[model samples]
Target: MLEVDGLTCRFGAKTAVDNASFSVQPGCFVGVIGRSGAGKSTLLRMINRLEKPTGGRILFEGVDVTALQGRDLRRWRARSAMIFQQFNLVGRLDVLTNVLMGRLAGVPQWRSLIQLWPQDDRAIAISALEQFDMMPMAAQRADQLSGGQQQRVAIARALVQQPDIILADEPIASLDPRNTRIVMDALLRINKHFGITVICNLHSLDLARTYCDRLIGMSAGRIVFDGVPAALTDTIARELYDLEAGEVMDETPDFVTGTLAPAFGTAAVA
Candidate 1:
């Protein structure tokens, strides 16, 4: 449902994303993995049009997303939602209200500014939180919750948007192992149940291997590997990071939750 061709983004003399090309099928879960400067986040931002590409084109359902502007761009961006590394919520607001803000795209700014969400919209927001097991925290201030709770709330916010695709940029980067599991499970549940295509940028190969249907590895500014999780051979892993496969696998314990690290080779990123 999404196609990217020769996508390049440069920041002056430095190229952050370069000549990358890939497609994502509707209802599929995709993982983009790489080291810190690997262009993973940049690529996702480009797709969401937060970062205008310096060259190339992006097509979503056969329309050129790179060319969208004004009302069309706003609507397209709303359809392709974003979940940031940081839980970008109004911390002082009640959790339910924060989630309700997802519907702001369809509401007038004046109404939203006055917190005048309709009952139907409030119902949908509440239901979304319930789906993520976050209903109990609906009345709490968002900043009052734990990191995991906040992330789940962020997911609920995205859900209430009724987005067709979610671009999660390192969604689990800051949480502990347990919270990591919680957030990852929420994303999995959304993708498997709702068939909302999810393209996530992840630092953990174990998570990518366990949860993603397919993995795309980025190096510097370009895509170096794109295939099913099972197809990410040890040799390719070595080439992607210039590390022995065992060395890469050894680092799994540092990122994944509990006993999940040991299952890197066997798990399906479920």
Candidate 2:
């Protein structure tokens, strides 16, 4: 459903993403793991066309997203939504309105300014909230909700767009452990139930291992490891994080930290 080839991005003289290449099939859950400044976030932005790549081609359903312009670019962006580390909701707006904003792509600018959404659009927004069990908070202001609630609302907003692919950059970074689990659960549910392709940049290896079907490890703006979660090893972790094997063991999950285990078995990576 999504293809990235020879993706490269530069800031001044330094490259943020160097010739990264990967493809995600429909309904797959892919995780991107690396330390700070590994260019994971940059890669996500480039996939969504928010950051123009200096070299490479990004194709969504066979359309070259990097070459898109004007309305075409806007359309592509609407088809593939991005959720940020921060919830990025309007603090003062009611939760329903925030979700309704996701329909802006289909609504006229004048109607949106006056907080007017079509009846069908309103129905879609409400249904999206219901999907995440966030309907009760629809009338409340965004700032009044907890971190988890805000993130769910953000997910609902993305769902309202009916996007084909979801790009989440550290969606659980600011939450506590319980909230992190909640957010991850919601994302997983969305991917499974809706069959939407999901690509996320995560800081927590445990979370990534537990939730992602495939993992991609990056270092110094390049992809160093790409494979199934069961194939990840202490050596690979050390290479990805630039740590010693012992240090990697300390960071790996207790069950599978020492040896490779069957997929989704008791001996799991974290």
TM-score of 1: 0.91
**Weakest lDDT window of 10 consecutive positions for candidate 1:** 261-270
Off by over 4 Å in 2: 243-270
For candidate 2, the 10 contiguous residues with the lowest summed lDDT are 261-270
Q: Score residue 64 of candidate 2 by CA lDDT.
A: 93
lDDT of 1 by residue, 81-115 (tens): 99999989999999999999888888888989899
lDDT of all predictions, in order shown? Answer: 0.86, 0.84
For each candidate, what TM-score against the reference?
Answer: 0.91, 0.90
Residue 103 C-alpha lDDT in model 2:
86
Error of 2 at 256 (Å): 14
Best by TM-score: 1
